[model samples]
Target: MSHPPDIPETDAGPAATPESEESLEVLRDILFRHYRERIAELEAELKRLETRLTDPQILSAIIAPALGNAIRQKIRDAREEMIEALYPIIGQTVVRAVSEAIRDLARTLDAQMRTSFNPMRAVRRVQARVSGVSSAEMLLRESLPFEVEEVFLIHRETGLLLWHISRDPEESADSDLIGGMLTAIRDFAQEAFGRGEEGQLDEIQYGDRRILIEAAQHAYLAVVVDGIEPPGFRAEMRERIITVDHTHEETLREYDGDPTPLQPVEQPLRSLITSAQPQELSPTQKRLLAGFAAVVLLCAAAFCAGGSYLWQTVRRTPTPAPVVIVPTPT
Candidate 1:
């Protein structure tokens, strides 16, 4: 009864279908996979280069005498260049280690800040880590030339000595000297944090022995090591304090107060050091010079008085002798 289905117009082409689009997508996927594999190959090469750069080979065997006499010439040349380029390397070990330690501390603090919201507590934690080392004396003693008599840890912010370890059992230190040191420490810390002032020398007179004092930020760490030379300890200690200051104080806002109760200075001078300079002598030299000067002055004064007395006696007797001679001729 319905009209017969109309046949498509003879000019009309077949309709575009979803299956054709699916086929196109498959082709795109294959291309993508090919590019991804190429990218992965490039990344693997990059990783291999990075590993080689970081993992240098041990050169000992390369230069070993057993390898061959022919290579020995090359090895000798390399060693000479290295030795010249890195002079006094052992002496610089402390400076290098201290610098690395500071850098590590800075990195640790930065990481902590990124993870935590509050800077206050995070910074304090960092300070505690940086300043909590009790083994520094032990570590430094082996490398240093002289024996360490006393090692003091101080709060750089407050100029208060946090802990004092001394080797001398019989030495008693004056309280006034310690206080003066604290004052110097505070002054140094204020300057160091604010202006990077290097430090000032303040000598503490303890009877015959002298305590060489220097100011450092957040703490005046002192070694009552014997001798007059200011321990080059300053550079390493300064590096540590500066590190703590830059990392903890500026960004973290964590400041430490006089945490350790004011205790009597009980540390003894275990070692003494003096600078090696002809112009600047040790304590012994200064004392000897003073004694020598005193003896010379005394001798000069005695000679001057004796000459004066002889002159005065001759002048007084001359007139009397002339008058007597005139009377006798008359």
Candidate 2:
């Protein structure tokens, strides 16, 4: 009777009862009721994330930094592989940029050559040969005419920049630094070269650039010039500095760090930034041109005389009569 009644025991735990399932359902409903907005928000965020993941631009933005890092790391690991892959792209970019720059330079050269066909250029060519420099170098030098780039009014004693003006919109100069340097150089020159003499360094030149300094009692004006300065340019600089000093004598004497007090001087300083004047022919150049003109006139006179003589001879000579040739009967 005991063997017959023995049943199979399961390994599983006790099955869920109906009451427990009902209690669980009630708890789930309570959670949903309390956090309904939170659940909806999480669902919306998940949907938005999915949408963003499908978008190519957003995906690229998300992956760009990582992809770039990975690429850089790969390049670091295998430089040869990356170089071989991107060699053509880099090579082409470099070649294209270089070619464009060369083309621009060639166009500029061609324009200069075409425009520089004048008597002045011819005279300069002769002068260049006499100067023992190459004609190309001479032409290049002459092409860059004199121009005032910037002007700085500085306190003579303290070397503080008072008023500054520039012709070029792109000319960003440290006026104070330039003034200080000029002052230092002047001081050094006075001590080294002209200690006893009552003189100052008037000009500081480097290559085609010149710093023309005009000193006064309180302040000095420094003019930045490019290329060779024309005649009377120094006198103009002197006049500018003198005028500035005379106009603002009281203010300049009581010099301080503030440039606002000397703001009015900018107008006068601006006047110094004049356009480059056209170069006039030298005495020798004028003489050369005169001689050339005389030779050309003489050649013209000789040609006219020869043409008139030929015309007269042709008129005096007798004309040859036309002869009719009768063909023999074949």
Candidate 3:
């Protein structure tokens, strides 16, 4: 006999009776009735968002506020990457702008130097032109003599002393303290006066002494001088700071409290003092220099005299006579 066809079992967990299905439906309505309006609003919002994504104007209107903040946050997070990527676009432009700014600054300073400030200015200017000297150089020469009293290398962010050298024994203050003070003064000036400008405080003049600042990547230098800055003082300081910054880039970037590793930096700093136009000589030093010069002259004279005597001795020496050779018997 053929077996009866098996009936399909209920796969929806358990088969609900008509009354239980009606009870579940009633329970769902009771729970969702309060949220039906809010649900409809959300569905409409989602549909509108989908539409907005396809429409540029609508999307911009929606994203403008958060988009700006998001972009800024991204830029802050990946600054170096952003810079590298943007360099191709803004690099040359920024370079040209900087060059122009520097050129303009030079011209402005030149104009200031070229202007007549004294009664004898015209005469001196003419003389300067005649002597083939730049007015800036001439003015520098005429300016009161200056001496570099101190050189300080400091961390840009923390203002901690990296290295220090001083020629002024009287004002031998703590270098770390001075560096912090300088940083404070700079911050105050920039904030109170500059108001978040791109540039920085370059010089601070106090009576006869002046502070000159040169900035680098991770560090900055402060040069204290008495009297006036010479023509090349700024350039020299700039070059020196750049050299130090470049040479010790990694060390400077990772600088800790200890500065023993940067002892070699003092040698370049020493040049600033010695390379000044005028270095006063003590009487003892002058005498020593004179004696040294005298010794050099005496040595030159002796060398000449020795050469003449040798020539005479060679002339007077007799030559060896040639001897006849005897034929060998075969």
Candidate 4:
């Protein structure tokens, strides 16, 4: 029956909905773009790998190890040079991967070391600035018997050396030594901030020689004295010491109640302690101390033997009282 031509269903199915169609279109575009970018990146990587593989030396470096198994398998298969042909491919792959891994590792390590202060830029900054400069040339030479050899300034901010100035520009100092001195400055600064007592160390090793470093308010002065007489070194050091003293005096005098900018003090003897005691010990004093110690030990041993001995002897050894023990009359 030629029935009414089945009226085309006006109700568009779910697929015909505008929102559904739009979402589907968006999804398709995203997938297409993703695949295209992925393919491009993969192609680039492949091209780089191919170039690395083509080098004959890289091939040899890679495949020189799998010679036996490859040869044996190729022989059993009756191929003339199958192993030889396969070697290049295998070697190239291995070498490229290894090279990439090594390069990545090296980059990572370099970054880490920089962050951790491998070369210590703070200390280097101080060294580069003051090194080989003559801060007090004529004053250094005339005041002291020996030449004013070196001037090392430990940084107040970073605790790293700001610079090491040599009296003569001929001396070479190590960065490690500078770093160690910086550490010492930091430790001392923490310990001696406002206690009024400064710290000094005799015979601190610089590079190879021992230096008597005099720490000041914000800096330490170091002089090289290998075989030079202590008296001569001290004489030279005294001039620098006096210079530092006068400089500090002048600064304080100039400073009014107003807040003055804290200038970096180049006190060569900045670490000088007003309380440095001479270490020379007398033999007689030592002998007397020994005798006194012996007597003390004997007395201690006697007392320790029993409390009875201590009470009867050491404790009851009576002294003349202000009032004598008089007998009371009935």
lDDT score for candidate 4 against the true structure: 0.55
Q: For residues 80-113, what per-residue lDDT tens digits would candidate 2 score against the true structure?
A: 9999999999999999999998787667666878
TM-score against native, each model: 0.25, 0.43, 0.43, 0.25
Candidate 2 residue spans exceeding 4 A from truth: 1-54, 67-91, 112-117, 129-177, 181-278, 318-330
lDDT of 3 by residue, 21-105 (tens): 8999999999998799889999999998889999999888888999899879989899998888889879889899999987876
- Order candidates by lDDT, high to low: 3, 2, 4, 1
Name the lDDT value of residue 109 in candidate 1: 52
What TM-score does model 2 achieve against the real structure?
A: 0.43
Error of 3 at 304 (Å): 26
- Over 73-177, each residue of candidate 4 has an lDDT whose tens digit, in order, gives 778896757768788998999999999987876675556445753223333334445665342332232222232345554433344554455544555668448
TM-score (C-alpha, index-matched) for candidate 3? 0.43
How well does model 3 score by local distance difference test? 0.84
lDDT of 2: 0.83
Best by lDDT: 3
The segments of candidate 4 whose C-alpha lies over 4 angstroms from its true place after superposition are 1-149, 155-163, 167-171, 174-199, 206-208, 230-232, 245-330
Better of 1 and 4 by lDDT: 4
Off by over 4 Å in 3: 1-131, 134-143, 277-330
CA displacement after TM-score superposition, residue 105 of candidate 1 (Å): 46
Q: Which stretches of candidate 1 lie over 4 Å from their true place?
A: 1-147, 169-181, 184-199, 202-208, 228-233, 240-330
lDDT, residue 84, candidate 1? 62
